[model samples]
Target: MVEQGKEQETKDFHPAPVWLDESYLEPLLRDLKKDPGLRITELEIKPATAKGDNYASVMTRVKILFLRSSAKIPEIEYYIVKTTYENDPFASDIFSKYQVSTTEMLMYEKVLPQLSALIEETRQPEKVFAATLHVDYEHDAIIFEDLAVSKHVLADRLIGFDLEHTRLALRKLAKMHAAAAVLNERKPGILTKFDHGIFNRYTKGFAPFFENLCDVAADFAATCPELGDHYARKLRELRKRVMEYSARVYDPQPDEFNTLVHGDFWVNNVMMRYGERKEPLDMILIDFQFCSWSSPAVDLHYFFNTSVQKPIRYEHQEELVQYYHTVLVETLKDLKFGGYTPTLRQFVLQLERGGFFAVTVALTCQAILTNDQTADADFNALMKDDERGRNFRKVLYHNKTLQENLKYMLPRFDRSGLLDVID
Candidate 1:
């Protein structure tokens, strides 16, 4: 069910693009043969998400009522459309520089379909991806059937995912990682262009943004009575090494298992369908804008830190990792992949080697995901170097919930030496 709050917020969102009318969509529908000779009788468009829900792209929900070629009655269909940021130049530049738009287009147009075909060959009952309807590079838009049409809804990001959801997510993630490995094996060098994830040499543009966030996190840690100055000092020192550390953590290790990491895997990107008893029946992953070729550990750390509930995130991590490993290895074996699949111990070592990513995510994107609903999420507003940006940073980092989470997490990170520089 669409939350009442979300519905009202959607109504209040910015207007849709001027060109996204019936004339532009009708031809696209015809190409997909949604209905031969169908005519769009009515068209509607609305912002697909509220502010802060997404930043890299503008999502608009498009709905059309059409008359079928042979039937007299009209039928309604819905689509979720993704286009590049219209007016946000900073976001546009960053996305372009990172090839985010082209990469996602390729994922939908090429990679994901092949991955799904491979999964189907395995006869797995689970569906792991959303169906892409069209990719209009001319308009810079990728359209997909709104998963809401199939009773899928996003889990609440603020409350985080419980044990059931977390395990389900990890299982699916492992399958994806396994499938990715087999896909790459079958078609070598297919994923070379995806080497750049969120942090790479091209990340100089975001250095201020990340550095400021680190400082904000440090200040927040300093104020916590339990953490005091020690952890704060550690975080501040870590700030200086942000780029270096990100480079090391993001680099694929030669001896470890690597797959196409869903560079931004968290609650919001994974949609779920539920049964009558409210148990999750199935799930699908969305948002390939940041997909990268990296260690599965990167995806593991990013998801656990940002999406899983604190109890499970802090306590049952071992169980979750083992469960994911089991599914991953089984899937790889079932697919008859020729590459070496890491043993559980090797996987654990990979996770340990990639442990700094947990700190990286927790200190940066986790706070963004957990921030109060009212926080300004405009990419330029958050990235600017003025007083306004400083205040916005305060709003993002000083949230009570985020503060509480940091209090719980910081000590663990310190003990693991994640907040310290490794020589």
Candidate 2:
């Protein structure tokens, strides 16, 4: 939620967070003071500027005041607070379960640290993840160092990233996956706690967001009735096929080549850093809410299909896929992985099985992209008009990017036999 115009002068928060309020604030401050390193004096909380975030996000901005001394530290520290409340109305009706939320904090508290250690031990230049400051067991909230204030800037979801951006992102992804593999190899069973895939859980229990996306795709395809019939028919049928088959996306037979996947890997979830020449420099992946165990191709197909546009994809699909596989193999081997890398054939099959997810993600992402209702709506504004918090089903059917990709990808997916209903 975008917090604007609600910055109060005192500790009395404007529409205080559901779990964190004045009562919790004082003690939380006290807890920090327990550490000799942190002699905090005051705190200021407000809504952070959230635009084009997940529909279920409830973010808060915190300003920490430290006691000034010879410690020679910056007096103010800023944090971005992320929480998924159990009783959130939208979360309840749409994405009711937040097992993903718990796992994300776990990943930060445990998984990511191990991964970072491996990266440093292996002397890898690529950075896999971001930094987290604090997490509350009771409030279901996590505080992260505010990267926004630094060279890091949010990736524009509407425009998406280009080839250079894609390569760097893939390298980072490989490092992360390899770290997990090595962590499991060294300790054995460290990642078991996150064995349940978040996408799998949501696909099974929540509303079929895919159907709504297919509905929009069908409508978008109907723009040219003659040429659109195949796409429209394919899309309409895809609605049913998607729900029934998508659950298997999380499953790979007998755990052949499973690794932890960043379930929500797309342009929006990444924050890109830029060099002075305006070239892509580095990135930090955010919104860890959906991290879980799955095939590496799950992340690959998602970014390649939805984020990479058709022209670039058509030109470089095989090369790009090979690049990702090569990096994954090299990174894992460097860390002395006990298991051999998945065969290229197996990776291709993973892409084939998981390609359907890209289709739905393409639809849902473009829907939210085209939908203006909340795209630009501010936090306080949504609070004032609760109707602004509607689902992505205001489904904008005529989105140009959506149409262009579908015209090309829908047929490709059909040819690859990814969409079972079409055949």
Candidate 3:
């Protein structure tokens, strides 16, 4: 969506609707209290996140000063309001095809509460998610308590996560998966509608986006002295099968461990709270718009390739996977899970089977996440095959850090047979 009332050169962002005001929020506020006399004294709205931090929704932070009773002091509340892009053809198409907004609303309205209750039932100390305040289905808006109030901050996407952050994230991820698996067993169809992940049979909206990014990767491979004709040709051919490759990798196999995965489990979606020593004390995952009922291995690959810092990204993967698998199995057993739990060998085998996913993320999502020139990047600039899109891709592919990451990763991917196209 293009920002209105600006020159062609200005960056685009989805603006909050004209209807968002004190009157529209009063009822939602009252729902939080039993006091019919609750009155909003003041309310302020501003852009919640910086450009390129999030893309699926327009994040607007609403700060409210309200009085629950005349006898009590007025209280302040901060909420991050998420709303969909309106009237834009691309937004309309993607939302309609995938029902992402609806799915996310369901997550907040139904799934997350149950997951939190499950953790509490087991008396586990793991922090699972932020508290959701409201879900406005009519307007496609979700109001969440701003985690910043609790001193939770997002790990640096450009710099990537260190071993501690990665370990904490994987541990929390395991708890979530374990709980969801048990929850699903109790309620068979709870996770049925969560199958529309980024790569699914329901839509091809990202096909062109991936194709163009792969092209950029191949072009970079050809230009870099270290990666000459051979890598370039491999990247080019791999570009053709991007969709099929991801589809196969995402497809769940029988007898393999599967549960609800945070499909976009990258740096942006993970928020961490640290201690005085800056050690990660807890991590909470956000953005359920891309959740899928698939092997947790896909999520593990996605997080490692796109979010972990390069120093440990490659060498320490086995350690991270083993730690996660151990936590997963322990949590499942603690929860009295009746289903088949995959052994470390089976889980590692599944991770290997889905190894191509890491390559896809490195070549596509990793480059986007690590690019610092994010102010001008948006859905239009990244998806459309126009001059603006091409220029944005140039900035993304040519990022110094991204180039270095590719240089270090391409050969490893080649060795893993991730670059080869299977007939």
Candidate 4:
């Protein structure tokens, strides 16, 4: 009976793996043959590097060996295959409940194709980084091109981004936002069709998590009170404000420039391929999981809050925000919409409200960024016990730097009289 109980416990607690079964391979291969009109002989699959907030699915590259009627073509070539497990928490449910996978598939099938065609028509020769979708329904899988070899460029670390790359990224973001703005204006029906219930769920659910993270920050501060006191106060205040902010629905104010933001716009999501001698390549934005119609300033605020180092925030805060705004205006001009130029006053209000939201996200994400990725541990192991000491140290270090930066930026918002405006 004891042995039986132990076995039952094991079965009950077992977690699903990131990758799906290899059994799904044959159907995908069959689908590829049918879709691409390629005569496939053999296919090999292997794990590929997972990127961009991906915790639920493992991506793999598939090597396809095929024969072509034309003799000039290569016989054995590889293509990337992305597959996801059906039982993943992020996967779709039977009742059409909230699921990131389901939402993404919906966006790809219904939303993205129309956007892609429109973008192509408007801006010829300057292609957006849109992934092709292939659903293998029999195997419950999907496959697409590996963006790594293509125009995509992932800036893994933010330690070495020069001004040029930063400028390029901002400009690309602007163009994307501008295109989205134009689309919303031209086709309000398309914008209205998206289910924003997921966003509401996120904003609502995030507050308590942020409060818990603040408690972690406070605990970290207690370890080195003298060194971390200022940051601890800042984090506590930020947590309180974020909780209040999250409760309010994000209604786009009239005359505000709304756009379909690449809601997750950190350095990692942008993939770039450089020219000869490391010149700037095209910026390919990926991971549309959180893409939504919101104030474009949200993207600008989020990118700066997450990507730019803490030290740079104090020194170049104004310059960075101004750069984003300038690019936004230029991109708007390109789209022939001069009426919606985002003012400094409006940007400051966004900073206050959007900055609160960003700080919460940053605090939650800090644990992932600072932890030892290779450690054989669960969430409790990393976040609880003596391991918490090491994690606390990392958080304290970042908290100090981030708090110092916020101290400098926050007062600017107050002085500009935008604090009251945002709320």
Candidate 5:
């Protein structure tokens, strides 16, 4: 009886490898074979590099050797398979929202192909707007062409994107935005087909954390007695607007200049390929899980406030905006889009609209972004998330990187009148 029990226990044990489901993989093989007409005679799956946000990721590098009926040489291709945590429901929910994976699926399958055709029609250079190999929405999984094989590398977020990188990213951004404008113009009801926005609700229960963070900011202000009252009043007023401002961009505005935003357009999501002279030649945007239809400014402010470092932001803020406008106008003209492009003053107004949201992120997320997050580790190295809420306020109080960024940003906010939160 004892031996039988042991055997039964052993039989019940089954390991879960979410990235290696045979049923989900057949479609990928079929898609791949359509071009080369070859079979993946053998393949192996192993873990690949991954990072943390909320997704409980199981990333696998798939190596495949193709078998052809009559081939001169055998070829090996590579792919990366990514999926949510199969074992942890709570973790999966935290990382993803109601239909985040499905949003990404639609972007890859429907939207990107249309964008690619536009790119070809307009006689543009590259299709850096999209990069997706295969997707399985039901499984909350995607397979990507191994970027390393294509000699592309993820830009470093800690150091931040320089001027050239900014231009490159923004140019591609403008092209996609141009496409969105034309498409929306043709059918007024089209943009609404996309999801509301990405990570817009990640700021849930932001009050407790914002209140605690205000106390921390007040303590810092006390050190400079001259600025104490100014900051104290600012923080107090800001506490009221934390949740409101963070929740502002969810719905689309019919009257405004709404365009699709790669909602999480930041340094890390951009991949670059350097030329012979060691300069960035081309770039590709990845991770459309946060794609949304909103003011084009949402993406603009996101890139400016999160990715661009202090020097570039201080020196070239206006210049960069102008440069982006120039590219956007040119691309729109190329597409035979006759609609009115927003003027420089109008663009600045959009920046002001997104400023509060930008400030909130800078105050709450710098530490998380600056930390050395390895594959096994996450952004919450110094903080944690639980039922009560995220411990971001504690990080604001103690984290050096967060403190330094706030110091840099607060003065700029005051100068620009962005801290006039009461109005």
Candidate 6:
């Protein structure tokens, strides 16, 4: 049976913590003071941009009072705190069932240092992707950094983009992939030590949930006669393929082109502040819970399918692929002593590999995309909403948007020799 607060329905649930309790705040303050004489006088928690199953997070602003020998010195204010929680939600019952929470804390203590070091080494101090773990072991709470103040980007808002913005963003992605690739090569043993058992455990239970969700979508579609058949057929196909597709696409083994991927690299996970009306000032990436070692193509394909608008995709698919490839090659050369660039033929081959994965991504994301509710809605709601119900009905009966996306994608893949590999 699910735990009271741990039900899947409450997965997206985040209750605000308006006031900071001294019992919880004291231990964390002690930890922060170990480095210096910073005393936190005020603590406030507000909603953060991301969410996960184990923890509810918020931005924390800390006002510090510093003791001074000099009269000129005054109180200092600084902001730093991160999502803090135990990993009890992730531990298996078979592992010390009675001491589950204790065991979870021990595991986090072991892993936290290595994870922190890796984040510090790879990312800029200001742009670190990994959350710092300020474990207040005594109180069972953690305090670290508030990412929103330093770096964060919104998901739903679409600002205008031109060719230059597209090129630079692709370059940044290439740099990320190259850095991961070099790390994997240089420290093969160390990198391999990080386990993906958590993903396997979470997704194993989630398979049945996804099937039920597809069924829910189909049931909703049935109420609308005109679109019912269409949605029913599409959901049926999705149900049949979901498991098989996941298995093939989620391989964790390392290859030359496989690197650390932002598994859900869509528009929402990326943040951009605009300079004027159309130009972007900076792009900040968030949500590292789904991040793992995977094919670089997965990240590239996801960005193309979900982030870029339809008009841009239809017109610029080939050019965009080439541009991303160019950046990837350049980045690898800089990161490695004598990294060899793929030939045009080899580049095209990699892009084909990306297209193969795109089929599964595009189909699954369609349920979220075309649904009337915001795409960011919880998975269960996406499955149950009536407008999505109507949309699914139309898809099942008429096969409109899915057909169009596939028709547009397949020709590009075929022309580029991707279909031959798929067949």
Please list the C-alpha lDDT of all candidates, in the order they appear.
0.83, 0.66, 0.84, 0.54, 0.65, 0.48
Q: In terms of TM-score, how similar is model 3 to the real structure? A: 0.95
Higher-lDDT candidate among 2 and 5? 2
Deviation from native of the Cα of residue 269 in model 6, angstroms: 2.0
Q: Quote the lDDT for 219 in model 1.
A: 92
Model 4 lDDT per residue over 194-304, tens place: 434323433343333446666665555555534356556555665556556533323454656667776667766677778887887777766565566676655665666
Steric clashes per prediction? 0, 1, 0, 4, 1, 14
Give the CA lDDT, 0 to 100, for residue 33 in model 2.
Answer: 49
Clashing pairs in 3: none
Order of candidates by lDDT, top first? Answer: 3, 1, 2, 5, 4, 6
lDDT of 2: 0.66
Candidate 6, superposed: residue stretches over 4 Å from native: 1-13, 17-37, 50-165, 193-203, 208-235, 252-256, 276-278, 337-341, 354-356, 369-376, 379-423
lDDT of 3 by residue, 123-207 (tens): 4556689899999899988999899889899888888899888888888899899998999999997885587888877787888
Writing each residue's lDDT as its tens digit, candidate 5 over 1-423 gives: 999975653343222365474444544676666644555566666555445332325556688766564665667778876665656565455446535667777787777767767666675657765457877776777777877678888777777778888888888888788787777676675655665464354434224444455555666655654456777678667767766665575455555567777877777677789988869988887767677777777787678776777777668878888888887777777788766677778877766766776766665444445544333233232223452233433433454545566677788878877677754
Please give, for residues 143-200, the per-residue lDDT of candidate 6 as tens digits.
4444445434453423323555555566557656656656666666443333232123
TM-score of each: 0.95, 0.84, 0.95, 0.72, 0.81, 0.64
Candidate 1: tens digits of C-alpha lDDT, residues 1-423: 579966666554655677899989898877776666988999988887777777677888898998878879988889999888866667778778777888898899899888887777664646899988888787678998899889999888898999999989988888888889899888888985687678766656677777889999989878878788998898899898887787677777667788888888999899999999999888899999888888887789889888988899879999989999999988888899888888899889889988888888888888788766554666776678898888888888767767877888888888887887777
Candidate 1: Cα lDDT at 84: 86
Cα shift from native, residue 188, model 3 (Å): 1.1
User: For candidate 3, which ten residues in a row score worst on lDDT?
Assistant: 4-13
In model 4, where is the ten-residue run with the lowest total lDDT? 89-98
